[model samples]
Target: MSLVNQQIQLVSRPMGEPTHDNFKLVEVPVPELQDGQVLVKHLWLSLDPYMRGRMNDGKSYAQPQPLDEVMIGGTAGEVVASKHPDYAPGDPVVGMGGWQLYSVVDGGQRGMMRKVDTTHVPLSHYLGAVGMPGVTAWVGLNHIIAPKAGETMVISAATGAVGSAFGALAKARGCRAVGIAGGPEKCAYAVNELGFDACIDYKAHPDLKSLSKALKDACPDGVDGYFENVGGMIMDAVMLRMNAFGRIAVCGMIAGYNGQPLPMANPALILVSRLKVQGFIVSEHMELWPAALKELGTLVGTGKLRPRESIAEGLAAAPEAFFGLLKGRNFGKQLVKLA
Candidate 1:
């Protein structure tokens, strides 16, 4: 059966903050599924900060989206029709499907579209806690930072998907986890709900030096591991308190993603403290996904790991959700429900 699909395309690249004019929503006919291909009806479309980088026409860890292309994203969907034997109709899977109502993907491209059992948790969790963001937190923390018992770890963007997972995992590993968020509500959620030992409000504490002092006060033991998310002043603040032989896992720089000029880096601190600061993309640690999923799923199933999702209904709201994510308006995982 032929299907009508609506997709949001990048109309223009933004200089700093992206406005609605940068996106154009268009309706088109869904392409026919080819051999070793499947037609998926997207259920949940994730709006992550990393998407901000893709909107620009620049070289980065991933390829930039060409002008007028459907915006790239991770999507959870059900297979409506399958030309491939590995996937059949009604199979729920997750993969790099664009922001559209329907998508057709070949078997090779659909390798990331692993079939999921929705009975275990809500299908949305697969896009959040059990998905890329969750895996990012797990792999980066476990493999890179490797926080030990009694160590102190600090995570920026602490209420969002990856940051939330980092805080929870750090606490589970017997380390003191401190979260840094934009507002009081998110800070409360990070501390009370996510079980972070303390949460700092960057908005409230605008001065990086003061924020560093506050963070150091909360983490009297010194910051052993830093999960760097928003990498502007917050990063500089956290760097001030890095303990000797500290490890920094640079997951993202949401603070600089909106075409901002790169800030001056202070290599002196790294040199003085002998800090091991490394940047990584989730794709680099795909081999460890099985282990991450098992641990994250078990934590969620046992009520230890809690995911808070800010879900926007309909594909039309996706652009707004994307804007909200960049502005720190999202409470947790920002998602658009397309199905």
Candidate 2:
């Protein structure tokens, strides 16, 4: 067993917004692995916007990250030592390994970890499209939003991991996919690179009313499905233009993640349109992941699904990168690469 572990912890609960002081990077001794436990050296760490909710001290679908505890996250790493027969040295796997260079994981806590064939696809891809983000998109689209062929679909945070995956899946299913991103570059990437039917730049079009009009114009058929990643005004705008019997999959609320309080939506519109909105955490839908992963992997391997990742070079840059993600500064799947 190792004597030291370098890790990041939550120093203070953020109020309006998180600052650098909210996180503290500290080195402590690694705990010894017990029977049926394995030690993993993390290679790739995923940074998703939903993590913001876990920082707050409140009851939600999942437990909040406790103050002064290691920040929780998903990571891809190789087992270095194992008392668990299921995992062994050099086996690449992914699970809830928190924000650390190394972790001692109990066998029971490991869910999705399996030896991977990195020769076929990059190991990091397991943390993105073929992993949580992909499953999030799949379940939201298929089970929740349920977009029909030739219907109009729109997604907020369109250049991000989950949002982009949603847009691509919508397009693949014969729906017209429209994306709302932060900037022109991201908009361009959404349409040109990601093959979205159209894209709206939220930064360029600051007026929610105008944005709503543009979205309505883009989808003359009316928005049949909305994959909501960024909430707040975007939700308001989309709700105004939603067609009858529209479905909304509430995947994230990145717009309010940086400490802003979300305004109440107009309930009248929901009543009038009979909109079906369902919020879900990926952890709750773990039962569907194996099937979702197989489908997503097929799409990626066959070139039907494309994932764009915004990678930060070192573990030290994760905090800044995460802050950028909350501000819509990242272009794709935000990840911190560990050496």
lDDT of 1 at 61: 88
Model 1 bad stretches (over 4 Å):
108-110, 262-265
Report the C-alpha lDDT of model 1 over 287-312, residue by residue, as the tens digit.
Answer: 89999988888878777889899999
Query: lDDT tens digits, residues 1-339, model 2?
Result: 456777889989888678889999999887888998888899999998888888988877788898888899999989998999888899888887888888888866647456666665678888888889989999999999887899999999888888767877888899999998888898998898788999988776677888888787777788899989988888898999899999999988877776678885687898899999999877788889889888778777777777888889877788899888888778788899986
Worst 10 residues of 2 by lDDT: 108-117
Query: What residue runs in model 2 are displaced by over 4 Å at the alpha carbon?
Result: 1-3, 108-112
What value of lDDT does candidate 1 attain over all alpha carbons? 0.89
